[model samples]
Target: MEIYNDHKKLFTAALCLFLLLTFFVAIGPAFTSQNNNAPLPGSKPLSSLQTEGKAVFIAEGCVACHTQQVRNVEMDKVWGPRPNVAADYANITRTDVWRNTATLMGSERTGPDLTNIGTRQPGDDWHYLHLFNPRSVVSQSVMPSYEWLFDIKDYAWPNDVVVNVPDDFKKGISGKIVASHKAMALVAYLKSLKEVTLPDGKPVPLFLYGKTAAEKAGGATSKGAGTKSGPDGEALYATNCQSCHQGNGEGLVGAFPALKGSKVVLDDNAELQVTIIMKGYNGRVSEGYGEMPPVGTNNNLKPEEVAAIVNHERSSWGNNSKKVTVDDVKKIIASFDKPASVAAKK
Candidate 1:
C-alpha cells in the first residue's frame, strides 16, 4: 500500500511540474515586449469595416470551411503565390482571434481557400449580386445566402425613375434596404487579396513582360518592341497577351507562338492573325495543341480594344510590320461571313 501511494505522489509531482512549465512558457510569450517587424503587403491597418467583417466571419464559423494559409507547392506553381510566412501573419491579431499557428493546421479544404480571395474576383457589382443570392448567379453553388445582411435599392435609369428588378431577382428585396455593409466589408477583405510582389515590386518569373532575355539585357534593337504601340496599345497587350506570350514576345514555346519573329505578325497579309483572334483556332494547323477561344468570351474586352491588341502585337514584337488599323479589323470582320476555305484560297 505504501509503495503504491509513493508512486502516486511522484506522478502527481511530475504532473504539477509539467503544468507549471507549460503555463510559464505560454505566459512568457504572451507578455513579451517584442515589436512586430513584419508588415502586411498592400494592406493598411484593418479598417472598422474590416474588423467588423472579421468578427462576423468568425461568428459565422467561416474558418471552419475556409483556410487562409496556402501550402508551399500549391503556392509556387498552380496558385501563383507563395505560402504564408510568419511575417504575413504579423498583422493578424492573435488574442481573442485564433493565432495563425494554432487556429487549425492541415484542415480539410471544405471551402475554397480565402487567402487570395480578395483579388480572385474583383468587382463591386459582382460581389453585390453574388451575395444577394448565390443561386441566382451560380446555378450550382452550395453557399448559404446571407440576404438579411443586405438592403436592396430600386434600379434608377437616366430619368431617375425606379426600374423593376429583373425576373430572376424578382424574389429579392428592392429599395434602399437591400444591401449589407457587412457583406461589402467581407467582399472588400476578399478583394484585397494579392500575392506578395517581389522585392523589385514586380511579379515573379519576369516572362510576364513578354520581352526576350536579349531585350531585357539592354539590347538596343529590342528596346522599341512594345514602345511603338503607345500607352493604349501597351496596356491592351499587357492585360490580354502578357500572360501566355510574355512581355518579351518569346511566347511559351509551342503553347504560345513567339511574336518576336512570328511569320503571322510580319506577313503583309493580316487575315490569319485577325481571323485567329476573332473566331479562335483549332485543328492541326496550330500544331494540334487545342483551340484558341474567342477573345471576346470574357465580355469585358471591346472590339476596338481587340484591334488595338492586334496592332500592338504586330508592331511591338521583333517582327516589325505595318500597323493594323481599326478600320482594317472592321473590314476583316465584315469579310468573315464568307467560308474560311474560300477566304484562305483568296
Candidate 2:
C-alpha cells in the first residue's frame, strides 16, 4: 500500500500511460490503415524522370511553400474532386534506402494542393514558364524562380527541349531558354501527381457533408440511360483532356494547341487525331505547340474511352463533325502497325 502511494511509483505509472497513449492510442491507427497496404485502382509507379524531379522538389524544399494534401473542408474543393484519402497516396514508394520522400502530402497551402495537378494544369510550357517566373502565368504568385534548372542556350539543337516564354517575361536573353534534364524531371514529377479515383463502393472523405448517404444512393444515376447521354465521354475528357486543353477546347497559347478551328480537329477522318492521342506528339512536328506526352498508352486508356474523348473534341467548339463511335476508334487503334499508311490518309 505504501509503495502504491509513493510519489516515485505514481510518477512511473503516469510516464508509462503517457507513452502508451502517444504511441498506441494516438499514432497506431495511422500506421495500420488498410489503404496503405494496397495501391489505389489507377495508381502507377513513378518513372525515372519523375523520380529525379521528386528529388529536386524535395531538395528545393518545395514542400515548405506548397502542400500536396487536400483537406475535407469546403474551402479545399478547389484542390480536388474529393478530399484525400489514404488510398490516394498508397502507391508512393520511398525514393531510396536512405530517403522516403515519396509521401509528400504537405500540410501548408502556401501554394496549393498538387494532388491533381496532372489533371488541372498539365503542360510542359506552362510548368516551365511558371518555374522560370511565377508571375508570368499567375500575376499574384510569390513563388521564386528556379531559373538554374533551365539553360539559356545560344541556339536550340534539333532535339533539345525548349521552354517557350512569352515576350513580356523574357528579359532580352539572347537565346532560347531550354529546360535541363532536371527541369523536365521536375515537371514530370509534378505532372505525375494526379489523383486516382477511388474504386466503386469505396468511401471518400465527406467534403459534401450531410450528403454521404444521398451520394451513395445517387451512384445509380451516374450510369446514364443511353449511349449518347452516357457519362463516359465528357467524364473521360474532364479526367484526361481538360487540363492542357481548356474546358472550352481552346488550349493555352505556345503550350497546348487549340482544338477550336484546328485543321487536325476539323478533319473528317479521325485517324490522325486518334493516332496522336494514342502514340503522343513530338513538339518538333509543329512550330507553335509544345510536346504532348503520350496520353493513351501510359494512362491505359481504353478504346471506348479514346473514342469518347475524340467525339467530345470533335463535336465541341463550334465543330460540326459526325460523332465517331467506339468501333471507329478501335479500327484506328488496331492499325498501329501501318503508321505510314494510317498517317498518309487525309
Candidate 3:
C-alpha cells in the first residue's frame, strides 16, 4: 500500500493515464477518421503552383487571421454554400517531397473564411489590388498589404503581366507594379481554395459533422441560403461585381467605369452588355480603365445568373432599359465565338 500510494508513483501513473486518454480519445480518433473518410466528389488536389502557393500561405502566416473551415451555423451562411465536413479534406495528405503539412484548417477568423473565395471573388484585378493594398479596395480593411510580393517595373514588356494599380495607391513610383511569380502563385493558391460538394445521398453526409446551434434546432440543416434556388442577381453582383462598380453604380473615377448613365447600360440593344459581361473587355472605355477581364468566366457564372445580373444593371440607377431575359443570355452564350471587341463595339 505504501509503495502504491507513493506520491511520485501516483503522479507518474496519473500522467501516463492522461497521455493514454488524450491519444485514444482525441489524437487517435482524428487520425483514424481522417484516414477513413473518402475524398468528396468535387475535391481536386492542389496543383504544383497551388502547392507552392500553399507553402507561401503558410510562410506568410495567413492562417493566423483567416479560417478555412466553415462551421455549420446560421451566421456562416455568408461565407459558403454549405458547411465544411472532414471528408472535404480527406484528400489532403503528406507530400513525398518536403513532406510539409497538408491540412490548413485554421481556427481564427480575423479575416473571412476562405473555403469558397475562389467561387466568391475570383477577380484577378481585385485580388492584385487587394494584395498590393487592402485599403485600396476595402477602405477600412485591417489586413496588411503584401507589397513585398510585387516588383516595380520601369517598362513592362509585351508579355509581362503588369498589375494595374490606381494612381492614388501608387506611392510616387514612376514604374508599374507587377506581381512577382510568388505573388501569382499565392493568388493561384488562394483561388484554388474552393469548397467541395459531395454527391447527394453519399454514404456519409458532410453536414453531419459541423452543426451549429441554430442548425441543430432545425434538424441540422447544412445548406446555406444562396443555394435554395437559382442564383440571386443582387447577391451575385454584390459578391462578384460590386467591388469595382460601386453600390450606386458609379464606379471609381479613372479606375472603374461608371455603370450609372453609361451608354452600354442605356443602349437600345443588350447584346453588347451581355457579351462584355460574359467574355470581358480590354478597351479604353474610360480614362485609365484599360482592362476588364471576363467577369462571368472568372466566377463561372451561369447564363441564368448573368441574365439576372444584366437585368438588374439595366433597370437600376434610373436607367430603365430593356430587361434581358435568360433566353437572350442563353443565345449570347451559345454564340461564344463572337470576339469581345466585335461585341463591345458601341
Candidate 4:
C-alpha cells in the first residue's frame, strides 16, 4: 500500500526493478558470452597495417554493402569453409569509448561475403587495380571505384608499387595509378579475413539442406562439388584466378595474358606453369600486362591446392594437357630455394 500511495517509494522500486532487469537480460548474457567464448584458433589480432585498413573499411562505408559473417546455410558455404561460430567473432570490440558497430555483421549483402576472401584472393596486384576501377576486372561490378585511395603519377618512383589498370578502363588518364597508404591498409585488412581451421576430429556442422547434411541423413543427394581427387579445381580457379583471367579463359587484353591456347598451359611438362604460380610472374610487364603476385605463396597454399589450380588451367577451355599430381608439383617446389620467382621463358 505504501509503495502504491507514496510517489517516492514507487519511483525507487521501479528504478531498482528496471536496473535489475537490464543487468539480468543484457549485462549478464554479454559477460557470460565473453567468458565462455574465445577467438578461434589461429585467428590473429589485426596487424598495424590491417588495423588501419579496417578503419578505412568502416569509414568508406564498406559495411553498408558487404558482410563479415557467413551464415549457416547451403549458399553460405561458398563464402567460408564452415559456418561461423560465436568464437569466430569473439575478438571484436567497440569502435571506441563512445561508439560500437557490433562486430559489423551487416544486414544487407549487396556485395560478396568477405569471410573467406583472404583465402580466395590473396594477391594485392589485382586488388589495387580493382580498387582503382571496379569495372577493370569485373565488367558487371556495381561497386564504386575507390579512386581517392590512389595517386595518378606521371612517372612512378622506383620504390612505388604501381597498379596496372587496363587501357580500356583507364578513361584516358595518362598517368600511372599508384596505391596510396590507405589503399595498402585497406587491402591488408581485406587480405586478413580468412576462416580458421577447426581442430582435428571435431565434427563440422553440415551446411543445412546441403549435400553434406543430406548425405549424412541417408537421403538421396547430388554429389558434392568437390573433385574426386582433392580440392575442386574449377572452383579454385573461379575464386583464385578468375578475376584477371576472364571466365572463358580469355584474359583481359594488355592486363592479363590469355590462358586459352597458351603454349605454356598446353605443354605436357608443367615446370614453367607450376613455377609461375608458386613464384609471382613479372616477365610479361615489358609487354603491358601487370605483374602477378605469388598467389600460391601469399595465400600459404598447400601443394595440392597449387596442383589443383594447375590442373584446372591445363584441362579447361580447349587446352587439353595431362594433369600433374600433387607429388609432381611438390618435387618442383622443393627444387626452388623458397618461393622467389624466376623469369618465365615462353
Candidate 5:
C-alpha cells in the first residue's frame, strides 16, 4: 500500500509539471508579440486582380528563381532596407496568404530582394517596359522574358495605332498570351513594397520634426516664414547624395551641375526645387551626361524627409531659399496627378 501511494504521488506531480510547461509554451508567442513589428496590409487590400496575379506567380514557379527577403550584411548595404521581420508578415494574413513555407530566407542571393521593389520602383511605365523586355533597360539581365504574359491589345499606343506584334516578343507555343491579368496583379503586389519606418515615425537615417525656420536657424530675427533644419539633413546628404554631387556640392562637370552656385538652387521659387527632386532630371536632351535618377527609388525616404533634404540643399552649401516643408512636398505629389496645364501653372 505504501509503495502504491508513492507511485501515485510521483505520477500526479509529473502530470502537473507537464501541464504548467505546456501552458507557458503556448502563451510564449503572446508575450513576444510586441517585439514582432510586422508590416500593415497595404492601403489597397488584395484585390481579385492581385489574387489572380499571385496565383500566376505561383504557377510560373518564379519563387524558385526569385526571393523576397533581404539579409542584414550581404545585400543590405547596397539595397538600403534589410530583410523583413515577423511584423512585416502581419499584412500577409490580411491577404489570406501567410507566406510561411518556402519563404526566401536562405543565404544564397540568386536574385535581387523583392522586399521593397514596389516602393523602390514606383513608376508604372518603367515596370511595363522592363517586363516587356528586361534587356531593354538592364544590359546584363539573365532572366527570361515573359512577353507572352502581356497582351498586345491592352497596350495600344498613343495614336490608336494597333500594332499586333510587339517587336521584342518571341514566338512561343501557339503564341498564347502568357502575360495575363495575373502578371499585372503580381506586379501590383511587388510595387506595394515599402521600407518599414523606425520607432520614431521616421525612416532609418533621416529624422523629421515640425519646426519653423526661425527655430531652425537658431532664432534668427529676419525671415519670410520659419523653416525646418537639423543635423539629420547634413547626415542624409553625406550618406546618400554626396557620392554623385561630390563633397563640396560641385557635381561632375557637364554631368551633375554645381549645387554651390546653381540658378535652380538660389531661385526664390521653391517649386522648381521640389519638382526636380520628385520627378528627377533626364539630361538626355540636355547637356548633362547621365540622367538624375529619382532618389525616391531608394524607398527608404518619407515625403517629409524628401522635403527636409531638399530644404537643406537649397538652404545650405552657400545657397539660401525659403525652407521646404512637408506640406510643400505633399502639394507637389498631388500636383503630379493634376492636369498638365494646372501643374505647369502651379
Candidate 6:
C-alpha cells in the first residue's frame, strides 16, 4: 500500500505501462507485417545496377519532387492504368545494410508519379536525354539538368554508349555525349519500374467518382472489364507514346520524328501500325529519331489496348485513316512470334 502511494513507484508504473502499450501496439504489428507481406506474386527483385540507381534516386532528392504512388481517384488515372495497391509495393527492399529508404512512395507529387513510367515511356534514348536535360524532351519542364551524369567526349569509343543530344540543347559542345556508368545504372532503374500484373480472379478496386478515361475512350479495363469496347487510345497514347510523339502528334524537331500527317499513320495497312506499336519501329532511326521500345510487350499491353491506341493515332492530328478492331490487332500480335528488334529490322 505504501509503495502504491509513493510518487516514484507510481511514475515507474506509468512508464512501464506506456512501454508495454508501445511494444504490443506498434512493435508487434511491425514484425507481424514484415512476416505477412511477402513480395507479391511475380514481382522481380531489383538488379544490382538498379539497386545502386535506387540509392542514386534517393541521394539526388528525386523523392522530394516525384512520387511513386497512383492514388485511387479519377484524376490520378492519368498517372497509371489502375490505382496503386499495397501489393504493388510489397517488394521494396532496403537501400543498403546501413540505411533503408523503405518504399519510395514519396512525400508528394511535385513532378509525376513513376508507378508505370517504365511502361509509359520505355524509350532508352528518351530517358537518357530527359535525365541529362529535362528541357531536351519537355520544352516547358522546370526540372534542372543532370548534365554531371554525362561526359562530353571528342569521339565515343565503339563500346561506349553515345547519347545523341539535340543540337540546340548541345550548346555548341563539339563532342558526342557519353553516358557514365552511373547514368546507365540510373536509366536501368527507371526502365525496370513496370507495373506488375495482378493474379487472375482478384477484383480490382475501381477508381472513385466517375467512368475511367479508358471507358470514355470506348475501351475497357485490361482485366477484361467492359470487354464490349476497346481500351482508351488517347489515354494510352498519352501514357505510352505522348512523350516521344508529343501531345499534338508532332514529334520534337530534329529529335523525334513528327507523327502528324505521317505516311505510316495514314496508311490503310493497320497491320504495320499495330506491329510497330507492339514490336517497336526503328525504320526511321537512321533519320536521327531514336528507336522505339517494344512498349506492348514490355507493358503487357493487351489487344484491345493496342487497337485503341492505333485508332487514336489514326484519327488524331488531322490524319484520318482506317481504324483496326480489337480482333485485327490480336491477329497482328499473333503473327510476330519473334521480336521485331530495332537491330534486326534496321
lDDT by residue (tens digit), candidate 2, 42-68? 799999888899989988899888888
TM-score of each: 0.45, 0.59, 0.71, 0.77, 0.50, 0.79
Better of 1 and 4 by TM-score: 4
lDDT (Cα atoms) of all candidates against the true structure: 0.56, 0.76, 0.76, 0.81, 0.56, 0.80
lDDT of 4 by residue, 255-280 (tens): 78999999889989888888888787
How much does candidate 3 score in TM-score?
0.71
* Predicted structure with the largest lDDT when compared to the true one: 4
**Among all windows of ten consecutive residues in candidate 5, which has the lowest summed lDDT?**
160-169
- Least lDDT summed over 10 consecutive residues: which range in candidate 4? 219-228
* Best-to-worst lDDT order: 4, 6, 3, 2, 5, 1
Highest TM-score, which number? 6
Which scores greater on lDDT, model 1 or model 3?
Answer: 3
Angstrom error at residue 339, model 6: 13
Off by over 4 Å in 1: 1-37, 40-42, 75-80, 94-106, 152-166, 172-177, 198-346
Model 5 Cα lDDT, one tens digit per residue, 130-166: 5656553443567677676676443444443111222
Tens digit per residue, CA lDDT, model 6, 1-346:
8868899999998999999999999999998988787666888999999998887887788888988888988888777768888778878867679877658888788788888887777788998889878987777888888899898888889888788787778878888899998888888888888777777887776888867666577745432122455465777787778777788998876568877999888989777777777777788777777888888877778887888788788888898887777888777777676586333453
Q: After superposition on all CA atoms, how large is the RMSD of candidate 2?
A: 6.7
**Higher-scoring candidate on TM-score, 2 or 4:** 4
Question: After superposing candidate 4, which stretches have Cα over 4 Å from the reference?
Answer: 1-23, 212-235, 253-255, 261-263, 275-309, 315-346
For residues 1-346, could you state the per-residue lDDT of candidate 3 as single tens digits? 7758699988898899999999999999988887689787778888999888988999999999998888876578767767887778887877667675758788888888998888776656677788998877777679998999999888987766677777788788788788898898899999888876568865432343466667545541111112335556676667767878867788766567888999998886778887788777776644557477788876667887787787768777787777766777788787676675446444
Candidates arranged by TM-score, highest first: 6, 4, 3, 2, 5, 1
Q: Name the candidate, 2 or 3, with the larger TM-score value.
A: 3
Give residue 165's error in model 4 in angstroms: 0.9
- Between candidates 4 and 6, the one scoring higher on TM-score is 6
168-263 per-residue lDDT for model 1 (tens digits)? 554744453344567767766555554554356533442222456665455332222334332366665665555445677875433445678787
